[model samples]
Target: MGCAISGLAAKAEFGERNTGDDAAAPAAAAYLREDQIQMIKESWKVIRDDIAKVGIIMFVRLFETHPECKDVFFLFRDVEDLERLRSSRELRAHGLRVMSFIEKSVARLDQLERLDALALELGKSHYHYNAPPKYYSVRT
Candidate 1:
């Protein structure tokens, strides 16, 4: 996926710094209280089952709002039809990968250092794929 965890970067330690427009998430998540964390974990339970579907929908919406973002994914760069991507095996696979990262990220929330490190690695990997943090957060 683009930048693994959009707002999880440790300052500018991640590959790219998000622009003002890209600063969608608050860093406050890093300071979430135990009760808040528990609430998030509980909320996630309902969404965990449809992780793949959520992943697909998230990307579809991303591409819809930011078509240029497709250039970051070789498989989608030349495709002119957006609807067809819905059933694309490649898209589905990538979606699953993205969702899997989110699942793991959520699982590690209680372990902030581990979660930050995970996001750090993924953010660093984005440079290799030319995926910028800009595409990580899109307006819906």
Candidate 2:
């Protein structure tokens, strides 16, 4: 009940929308600042190859932050040993594959179609995992 969002669409109440505030609405832009883009590109280069490791750490941290999250993964659902789960080959494969797709998404951010396809694939996987949209946000 405390700000739990569970859907794909974000819902925020900032008073009424469609209240003839057209002039106050900001324009959306496709172009990112060159410096920011370059910084992201350069930063990503350092960690791109070790995305699997990154993914592993990220999951570990997520579970650490909220142990309940481990329940979402059937393989790790009943894992009694955190270390064992960390070294799990199945977990490694899944984490690596997911990370690869994320890396691909970043690399292809300029391609809207590719991003959309990746999102669609994620949505399907989420359905199977029973992961709420808020779970993907990692802020729940």
Clashes of each: 0, 0
**Tens digit per residue, CA lDDT, model 2, 87-111:** 8887788788877876776666566
With a 3 Å backbone cut-off (N, CA, C), the pairs that clash in candidate 1 are none
Report the lDDT tens digits of candidate 1 across residue range 60-97.
88899989888889999888787888878889889999
User: Which runs in model 1 stand beyond 4 Å of their true positions?
Assistant: 1-28, 133-140
Find the candidate with the highest lDDT and give its number: 1
Which regions in candidate 2 have their CA more than 4 angstroms from the true location? 1-31, 133-140
